[model samples]
Structures are given as C-alpha cells and as structure tokens.
Target: MRKKLASLMAVAAASTLALTACGSDSGAAAGPENGDKKELTVGVFAGWDEGLAVSHLWERILAKKGYDVTLTSADVAPVFSGISTGDFDMAMDVWLPETHATQAEKYGDKIVELGTWTENAKLTVAVNKDADIESLDELAGKADMFGNRIVGIDPGAGLTKAMNDRVIPQYGLEKMDFVTSSTPAMLTELKKATGAGDDILVTLWRPHWAYDAFDIKDLKDPKGTLGDAEHISTYGSLTFKEDFPTLAGWMKDFKIDDEHLFSLENAMFNGADTQEYAPIVDQWISENQEWVDSLTAAKK
Candidate 1:
C-alpha cells in the first residue's frame, strides 16, 4: 500500500510538469491578448524615400500605442527576405504588378500583404525638364546630350533591373552608360546636372519628393517596358496577423495619397539638416493630427 501511494504521487508530479511545459510552449506562440508581445520589427528598404517616410511614421504611431517598434533598414532583396522568414514583422514599400514583382514571386507564399497605401508608383528614366529629348525612343540618339550615361539607383533595385533587361534593349540604348550607385549618388548627380543647367538622365520614380525638389520630367515609355502604375503595398511576415492583430487591422485600413505622402517625404528628406527622423516624424504627425489620428481610430 505504501509503495502504491508513492508511485501515484510521482505520476501526478510528472503529469503536472508535463502540463506546465506544454503551457509555456503554447503561451510563447500566443497572441498579444496575453499582454506579453509588444515588440515589433518593421523592415525598410534603404534609400527608398517612400518606405523610409512611412516606416518612420508608423514607428512613431505604434510606439505611442505601447508597442516597442524597431525599424530595420536593408536593401530591397534583404527586406523582402526578412519579411518572408519572419525576421521582420512588416515592410512598408513593396511595389507590385511591376517593381518588386521578382521579390513577390520569390517570397509570396511565405508573407502576407496587408494592403496598398498608394497606387501611383512607377519606374522612370527621368531627365532634366529642359532636356531636348522627350521620350525613351529619342534617348538613344541624344544619349550624348546627357553625357551618354544614365544615373541609376541601387543595383539591386527593380528599377535598375528593368532598365538593364527591358528598357535598354527595347529602346536600343546599349551604348549609353548606366551607372548603378546609391539613390543619394543618383540624386547628387541630378542636383549637380540641374544646377549647372546641363541635360542629364537618371532612374527615378513617382510619389518621390524629388519631383518637388528638382526640375525634372520622366521620359515617355511608348513600349511600356517599365510597366504601368504600381501599388505601394505593406507586407508582413506569415504570422504577422496573429502576432500583431492591432497593427494588422490598422495597416489594412491605412491609405495615404500622393499629396500627403509627398509632404511627409519632403519633411523627412528634402531640406532637412539632419538624418535624425524621430523628431521630424513627430512634428509631421502633430501637424497632421486629424489624418494621423484617423489611422488609429479603429484601435479603440
């Protein structure tokens, strides 16, 4: 009888331990309703102004709502990969139906798209407004006029890929030198060329603050090689909705037009003396409180 009682007690103890271990494992995977999951990671594609602008905006907004949000910047490819692998909770500037389509195809199954914030994005080969040529077809003949070079953004950018694979071949611009450098480098070239009143060509995009900051125009793409207007979407990790239900709902409802997005971009990038974005984003949010508040209206 004594041996049987000791055996029963040991079995009960083992069962309790097993249940506790299982509970701990389940709790780790549980949602924020448990009140322990507050950290969020947002991925930003480096040198993409729209991404930078919106990411910073959300970081401030989420932080105010008790989330410890962290912004991680990387090149386009890495950002998408990080989102797919759940390393980052979300990415703000994924252009679809054209730009970033490659990344989408590669990781589409592993990630979730919350929604598109803007639909006016497109890749372009922009030239000085006063440049003699008006269309991509005329660019080859007049390539020398703009120094026989095309200033391009990051080499891994979808814009660079489109320019190299489709635009150049379609338009017979093989002779023109396409420079693959950072966006800042391309912008520097743009500023210097425009400042000197020289004709220049560079890869550019819509919804960018550069149009407001510089005197430039996108050359016509008669062949439609650069693709049509794309939607700038917010993408997340596969478990994003479960991990951050509040953010998922807010992001799905989030929409910003060109006018407001450009304003935010200009404030963050154009004419700003410092690289610090926290204060700038805060100021922008304060000025646009009504609209900004609307972003989180569903939260409460």
Candidate 2:
C-alpha cells in the first residue's frame, strides 16, 4: 500500500513539474512580502472532482476580487501536509469523521477550519439501480452476480482501507476479489458496466459527479460499517486567517447544497472533454449569478 501511495506521489511530482509554469514549484507561500495576501495557493486532491470543482470556483471568485490564486494538485495526504506546513494556503475538500479522518488526525492541529460547505458527503458501495441486491449484507451471497469482485479506487484510499478492514470481513466477502486502482479506471469500468447493462459493484462516494452521471444507487449498509453522512469542509494553514482575513470570513460563511454542487460538477465533468475548468466555472457562475455573488457578498 505504501508503495502504491509512493507511486501516486511520484505521479503527482511529475504533474507538479508540468504545472511549474502555472504555480509555485516548491509549493511555497508566494506573494508580496508586506503582509498583502493577494496571492494564495490552494491544494487540490487529484481525481477528486468535488474538490477540483470548488477550488476552481474559488480561484475564479478570488481572481475577480483581485487575488491571484494558484491551484496545486496532489494526493490527499500531501494536500493535508501542504496545508500544515503552509505550502498551500487552503484546500476546499476535507471529509470529516471518516474518509479523511487519518489526515485530520495528523494535521488537524496545524490548520484552521474554514467551515463546511456541504454535508452530503459519504463513502459508498454502489451498483446499478436495477441490480437485484439492495443491501451490502446480500452481497456475499450474490457475489457471483457482480463477477465475484468489488471494484475500488486508489489502494491507499480510506474507502479501500475501510473495505479491507471492515466491510469485506464483516460482510463475509473473503472469497471475492477487491480490485484497487485509480478513480478514473474505476469510473471507466463503471461506465462500461452501465453502458453494457451489467451489474457492477464499485466503491463510490456522495456529492460526486458519478451519482449524477451514472444510473446507480448505494447499497444499504445496515450495520453502519460504511459510516453515516459526513461534512465536506475547507481547511487552511495556521497563518491563513492572519494573511487573508477577508477571504477567511467569506470562507467561514460559505455554503452550497448538494443540488448546486452537483450542477457545477456535472458542468465540469459530465461529458466534458477538456480539463480546463475556468470557462465552465465562469459559465456556471454566470448562470448562478445571485448565488455566486452571495458567496463573496459584503458581510452585513
């Protein structure tokens, strides 16, 4: 697992190399030295669409406010570490009490909580809506129905850890194989399975574009193994508030429900070919002018 995580980090390093022209290479805090917080850096979890969406949205929002925001992409753990060491000023998505619990434990004290923007987050195991099973308890008996396999995301993902340590064993799925790879690979398989009208079991999460893009439903976790819904939050470095007081207040009051978040995700992800999300976010902002403006509105 550590090797796999190291491999992912290697990929991130390569990506960081490519992104040098766009942002700081060392992930350093960059700006004018006179306590001017016009420059900001946000660390984004690679492949996490919700984080990517909100981060880009803020990059657009802050840019309009005359702030130069740099969005840096990395793995989950690195993002948290960057936040702690002040390399990244903020990160938009941190799942609490479960999925990112490990990161929160290690870096919680070193960062500032910027408030939760949404509470519709959760780790889930989903199958096509028409699948015969409705609950995870029924999966073992019907494992063959899903080709006796459970597709999963990154090997080092907390969801995969939960599955390996709790869900599979607690549910008596020792005989079946749980595949772990990248999120895109898992999503590609999901797309293939759904397109072919085949029953497929895959690890997924809520507040994700997949829910809107795929015709699937989360299987019931009657034993509470997968955990209840969690909040999606933003966190910042220790000096974030001191450096960016105005932006800090806006972040404290930030709120976006699942419906609006999903729309932005769909616009940026669902059937979109390019990775450049600024224009898409700009379009979304144009359409949701009232709400977008409210995000940065003058405090009463």
Q: On residues 1-300, what C-alpha lDDT tens digit does candidate 2 reach at each position?
A: 111112333335314301213243222234332344867888877767788788888887766655667788787788899999999999988877666778888887999898889887777899999999999999989999999999998887767888898999999999999999877788899999999999999988777788877889999999988778888889999999899877888889999887788889989988799887888988999999999999877768
- Tell how far residue 93 is off in model 1, in angstroms: 2.2
Task: Supply the TM-score for candidate 2.
Answer: 0.82
- The local distance difference test score of model 1 is 0.76
lDDT of each: 0.76, 0.80
Model 2 lDDT, full chain set? 0.80
> What TM-scores do the predictions have?
0.75, 0.82
> Which stretches of candidate 1 lie above 4 Å from their native place?
1-37, 75-78, 102-106, 144-148, 154-157, 175-180, 271-274, 298-300
Among all candidates shown, the one with the greatest lDDT: 2
Which regions of candidate 2 fall more than 4 Å away from where they truly are? 1-10, 13-36
